[model samples]
Target: MPAAHAATPIVIRDIRLEGLQRIEASTLFSYLPVKRGDTFDDDKASEIIRKLYATGFFNDVKVSTEGDVLVVQVAERAAIGSIDFAGIHEFDKDALTKALNSVGLSPGRYYDKALIDKSEQELKRQYLTRGYYAAEVTTTISPLDRNRVGILFSVTEGPSAKIRQVNFIGNHVFSDGTLRDEMQESTPNWFSWYTKNDLYTKDKLTGDLENVRNYYLNRGYLEFNIESTQVQLSPDKKDMYLTLTVHEGQPYTISGIRLAGNLLDREAELNGLVKIKAGDRFSAEKLQATTKAIVDKLGEYGYAFATVNAVPQIDQEHHKVDLTLNVDPSRRVYVRRVNIEGNTKTRDEVVRREMRQLESSWFDSNRLSLSKDRINRLGYFTNVDITTVPVEGTQDQVDIDVKLEEKPTGTLSLGLGYGSGEGPIISAGISQDNVFGSGTSLALNVNTSTTYRTLTVTQVDPYFTIDGIKRITDVYYRTTEPLYYSSTTDTSFRIISMGVDTKFGIPFSEADMVYFGLGLEQDRLDIDSTTPQSYKDYVADFGRVSNEVPLTLGWSRDNRDSVLIPSRGYYLNTSAKYGTPITGTTFYKMDAQAQYYYSFARGFILGLNFQGGYGNGLDGKPFPIFENYYAGGIGSVRGYESGSLGPRDTSTGDPIGGSKMIVGNIEMTFPLPGTGYDRTLRVFSFMDGGNVWGTEGESTGANGLRYSYGLGLEWISPIGPLKISYALPLIRHANDKYQKFQFQIGTSF
Candidate 1:
């Protein structure tokens, strides 16, 4: 230790620094308050030492006088050479590294004993948040060569604490079960392992508390109060119990509801939006909804910064509340610019063209929301967010920033499976929905099975023109040989077909499109002595080789909220294809289908589908066997074999697809019990009724309406979409084929 000096100033001729390895001498000079030419004193020397120590780059700093010169010495702290973690099983290594880096405890940084202790506490705190009440984190420092050190954190994370019981007191209007049902966190059950709702955390408890409060407030408990909540932990710290005590006040009713404040002379319009009325029970949910609606309505009129406040005046004597809505139309703003960001793969124009909200236009909340939805529907991004920022110089101008996280839009599918009908199948396909980020689609598919082999190539240009017209071209070759499962004799023949089709879609509206198609097809049949009589007859009538030209017209409308997982929407499609008499084979086919989806609750959906098709020979000839419609599969009636629902060949007992088809399905879809809001996985219950009839038979009758009820699971896996179902037939004929369990990979239904 240096001795204390007198309170006298001295003139310094020179100054020197010592004990610097990595730090520069100039760096030390910059922090010193005393200069060589300036007078030095004890106070100045003290300031120099204090500032150097505050830099956190030194372990010790001292200043002393040597003759007419001032000498400063600093012992630099050891730099961290490496940081390692041991016994860390609960959290990911990358995540922990980031957390430690955020607290200034990373490799290549100077080591501080105080910061090391703080970092340990932070690690333990994180474990606590994850319900690891018995977690222990201890840090060790190992000396290394050349004034460097290594930090090692050993963590012991015990079992996560589980909630054993939850009790609510002072609840008269609703039972404890009812209140518990409203909470997202709960005690252990069959699904606790997946949902983790049994685990207790401060954030979960806070959210649960809010939910409880909202339940009472919405039910007209005007003065509901949660007095206290106690969370008791077991002595072993593996179990927890929670108790919530509350005071349930008297229920209240609405005496009067009025709209005050700036209505902008639209009092009638605003009043119509109010959901509350006099004599109705006071509901906090309804009040908040009404307030938000009014604000949104104002936003539609260019008042983007509007505010609506619901002020409740309570009459204690009568147990009634009068509601007043106060609106503030802050300013009418216009958008100055629309900025796009975070698109590393997709082109700017590809995303910008979908925007309905243009720069320099008055801000419309509906248009902005529609723009975001349009971007989402493109399926190019996993997440999309939009934020509005007021312009720096003006109050009436704002900028819109669209931030997106892009996802892979290309898919490669490879599948190998065995089916009862198709002995073994192998399929491979590659598709690019956003080809080169130009928003074009190209796909190539090849499927080979014992019964059928197909090769197809398709390309689509969604923006064939600047007006949003779409063009699609397809070329395919397919060969099919029916296999006889019940007969010992090989009586089946092979049919080969090659076709090319081109279609153009013209947009009629935002959700509607009209399509026109033209195609040319050639078919050839190979028959032998043991061929089926139906095939022989067809070959005799239509010849072995036939050519046809088909003209198609179609109209479709889609308003689905999401193409992948639609919660609410409707889809309608109708198409007709006619084989002109000018061509070889003459036939006409007409089909119409409609589907509707409704989200009845947060995670529940109801879907209805109906489809019908009719086809016949135009010039009094038999309908083409190759163009017949088949039903009863995963996409149709699940309880029956694929393509085995129509008329059957007498001797072969094989399904010969019919010319008329009718199908209807009703389904209710909900999230899995423990999946939360994950839409990629869902379980659904469905009832399907469908059948096919020959051209000579009736289109509809109770006898032919095959019905099946089943439970199905759908998962959008990383490889592709997968569907599995278990079904039971409601009405079955003696000869009807039953396929109770069915599954398919790389397809969507």
Candidate 2:
């Protein structure tokens, strides 16, 4: 704007402001450089215009002098009244709004055309990442009252582009199929809809390229190179094809590996950590493992910042390479502080008590790793991480930070189930693994069925003593009516049992615990005319009611990676109980179970379980029939009726009980066809073999080992874990009762 006094400068007596709406005149005056009683000229007028425009509050600014008084006129920009999205199914509206807000396009902010265009581009980019190659974004601005505007982002997201094929030009040692297997992206397949492997994404392609490079490098292709990659989109923009050009150079062998660094006078121990030796095929994985092992070894000795580098010496003509592991122990640091984070509900002491590395102690990576594993085993947290951060201005000091993500530690369950042999069963349980954030546990469970009923209450204190011993107390009452015989006769016969026990667990190692307990138990037998002869004889010999004091000893070890969906590790549990003749019959019983899980490939796990039990009476007395072990059920052997594989009553032909039992299962679990690598839902194939044998009962036709093979589905549902299986019994005996289908909830095999 031209000043009225353009020829010369003028002395302003006052300043006048215009176009004030949402913004006040005082606010504008604070930003103005030309104030009241100040000299004004053409240069000052130009400066005033620039200053007002730079504030972003005004869309237009005009500065002029009226009779030596400066006049500043402005047209303020419209504030955003509202922001809306249309046809946004792929993204949440709030999420898109947040994204736009990141780029200065939200309600209450001055609307800018440049920011609108920028936000449109950003939205398009977001859709493109999700394979929406034909997505279009447009912005519309509508004037509202009070000089405000509403923005509408209209998105047209077309069909996603699918990967048609992935081709490799020059891979000699491996076929195109093998190379494609190494990449996550692939042509449409049966499982493509779920895994989205057929979706063409730039980030996934980049990662696939890196994986291909590593595949060749790890297989002794020292000079492997990806010459180029071409991603072609079809004319319709609905299909994508990727072609990678590669040069797989000749494979090289490792000539030798030597350690050359400060090994802390433990050269021999460090050398043993090297997995690759002389005359071996070159492998990048082994080299990386070797370096990490050396670094970890030094970390165990308080070298928290240790470094190990594998410097390779390549020979082209000889096709050989030599590796030199250079280790650097930078500094020996001690932990200055141990910081715990993200334990919102759990007490700090509950977590701190699990740490193996204490404050003001030497940093030991081994101890830190063990601490993480222990916390995970607590089953109270969903995620746990431990990291070491160097303390500022300290050469030999560091801080250990423990980060945790807590999960729901309480479970309230109500289950309704039906067993072919046992009839309708109802169960309910309420348990808390971390009660009151004190690392204590309490649980109550009740189950009732036509043939059996039980109630149990348990409490545990994990830190009963300062020495890491655990105390457990349990009280239970149970009643059972042998299903097989109950159906054969109209008479009623039942066994009632009640017990109270207390145990102490002492940790022998990181993975092992030993338990000792003593308990008082009472058992009563109610029999009628049609009662099984075995039970009648037992009562005749030992009386109808018995009370005893029992002593129990047990050992357990668990190191599974995940308790919910374990992919690797082993678990073992063994227990023995001896009934003393304090008031009744004396007997001995032992049970052992061992489980092993191995993950051989991605999303595939192999599990093996073995169980055995043996019981006998002491002092030449017969073992109590009520105390006999029963097998052939969901947890024992599938495809057979519960407790139906044991010796039977000689006359009634009903399975009575057994003094010895053995069971084994081999199962392979993999991802469900459409679930990808989700562990929550899976399918498994299993072979089960088991039986129950009695040493003194009448031999029935179902007394031998039974075998079955089956397929099962496992789902971690909202209520609990559910397992359903359909089995075909093998070598069926004429008298053996078979149940081809079985299912259970809130249990794991």
Candidate 3:
């Protein structure tokens, strides 16, 4: 032990502090046990020294008495000038800095040797949690002038400890492979590098154990329990082994079920929501689901704080369990206010108008969910969250807060590409779905290619009136150079068209809508000797120019869960267009389409689509060739060239489209492997079967159905939706052009 610096017993008139660079004299005095007009003793001096040192702001302390006055001095600790790290590739610098800050060791803070040691230990512990068992951290403090210092934490993060084996013991009812498959962490495999499944984590192990428990519980093992979990690391710390022991009790069957507690006089309705029944095996999952359903039912009746719990009665000898649902319906609550937040760019009214639930109304979970869905369907936000807050003074009044994160709703796209059919193509478009945050849309597009050129402008007002009437207007101009495949030589001709259309949509229900429109169009065909016979005949009958005024009626119903990436629900659309003979060339067109989606599991979806169209001339006039349907290419039949599926001219094998069209598509979409729950990227396998027929000329019936199967990838990139596909045709004609590989960027299908 070192000799005592002083053993003083004296009365201090005033205490003076010295050697403090940043700390104030008053701060030292406040921490000192002995103050002015107090007696100073050895014990007080020792206590004062200990407290000051404990503050972690001082390096040394000295006390002395000078002529009945005490003098206290302290050498303040050096402030950290900078904190840097070396060889830290596993963790980011910012994260390490934050971790050091949590341990009171950061730049601009007073440095202490003890704190540095603590921070190093914490850093090493963090690395261990991340499977970096061989990680080493060495901290260096460099002294500088002006009582400042710099900290350098050098880290050597070795290879992560990979899981070599995972074994489950004492599970008699299930195989070891089955239990291991339920765990997120697994032994090294082909996908281990990407999925990081070979790395062991305590949190992951905990979750895996819970999942194992739930698995047994859901299978009628009412008394299942996990005994212990052991993790063994190799001597080199480069590999790990995990073993889990579980006790799965005998399976039990359900003997009876009963409902108790407050039912709000809706016993029959609540009972109908119970999915579990007598004579079935006892299932924890079913019981929990039934409880949730009962609670949701109560919520529909304004019982916002409802609770339902399933209490089980076990018969040990009989191996049977009886369940009783206990329900408690707290006081019904009413919404006092609805608050919208986090929408910096969008106007409040834009979101508020989509909400179905109103303030001052009884709380309804269904309406609240619908409101959230409607806002999500607008496609203006990335995330939407709704939370209920109880009122401070009232028990039956609550406030709803709708929080949202806005996303970009305006798109500016430019595309340039070359294809065999279209030659060199250049396209550009600018669209705004939420124009000026008014919930209106405007778009303008221009496309130029060797075979076709077009310019279009469109505008839509979703809420043109207070009654939810939608209005859409469109104007377009197009020119096409038909390049028909000729047996001897290539032939071509030119056609120009311009048109304008306006439509009004009336909402009949939340999901159904009816639309009526009128359009005026004119077409002029330039005939040449090289032109195909189909085009020449049409020009000779209808002249070089033809005019038409068309009336259109359409009805659509959309109940999809999401408009951008729907996984459930269905959509249907039907429309008819009739060209008035009194105005110009007479023709009529009818089209009907339906799409359905089914979600089989998390991140798995099945989609089915069907479309049919019929077109013919009125008053015995032949239907205009331009008014025919062309099916093929990326959006139609994937394995064939664009517009190459229908009837072909005998002399020049150019496709003439068709008056009747039918197409059906079935697709299964799943998340990309190793991508977890990321919905932005997906992979899908599809089967497409469809064909176009022409009643105006030659008829190709059921035999014309072209079937194709392929796998495709869809990515929601920053610019737009992109699709890449590789397909093979199952049924094809000899002359049908095959395009096995196709892709489209900056477009949606």
Q: How far is candidate 3 from the true structure (C-alpha RMSD, Å)?
A: 5.0
Q: Identify the leading candidate in terms of TM-score.
A: 1
TM-score per candidate, chains pooled: 0.87, 0.85, 0.82
Model 2 lDDT tens row, 643-725 = 77878777777777788889999999998864446799899999999888887535565446899999999988876687888
- Of the candidates numbered 2 and 3, which has the greater lDDT value? 2
> Model 1 off-target regions past 4 Å?
1-51, 62-74, 330-337, 341-348, 359-361, 389-399, 403-432, 435-437, 444-456, 477-498, 520-532, 543-547, 580-584, 671-681, 697-703, 746-749
lDDT of each: 0.84, 0.87, 0.84
Task: Sort the predicted structures by lDDT, highest score first.
Answer: 2, 1, 3
The 10-residue segment of model 3 with minimum total lDDT is: 1-10
lDDT of 1 by residue, 1-749 (tens): 24225368788899988898889888888887778788888777778878888898898887888877888888999999999999999899888888888888888889888889989988988888777899999899999987899999999998888888889889888888878876767888886776678888899899989988998888788999999999999988899999999899899999999999889999999999998899988899999989888988888888889999888899988899998888898999999999999999899988988898899999998889889988987889999999988999898999999999999989898888755445578989999989999988899999988778999999998889988889999999999875344223575577899999999999988799999999988888888877656667788877888788889999999998866677899999999998764445699999999989999886899988899999998767878887788778677888887777877665556666788899898989998775655588899999999998885532212247899999999888765567788889998986678889988765444
Error of 1 at 296 (Å): 2.7
Pairs with steric clashes in candidate 3: none
Ten residues in a row with the worst lDDT in model 2?
482-491
TM-score, cand. 3 vs. native: 0.82
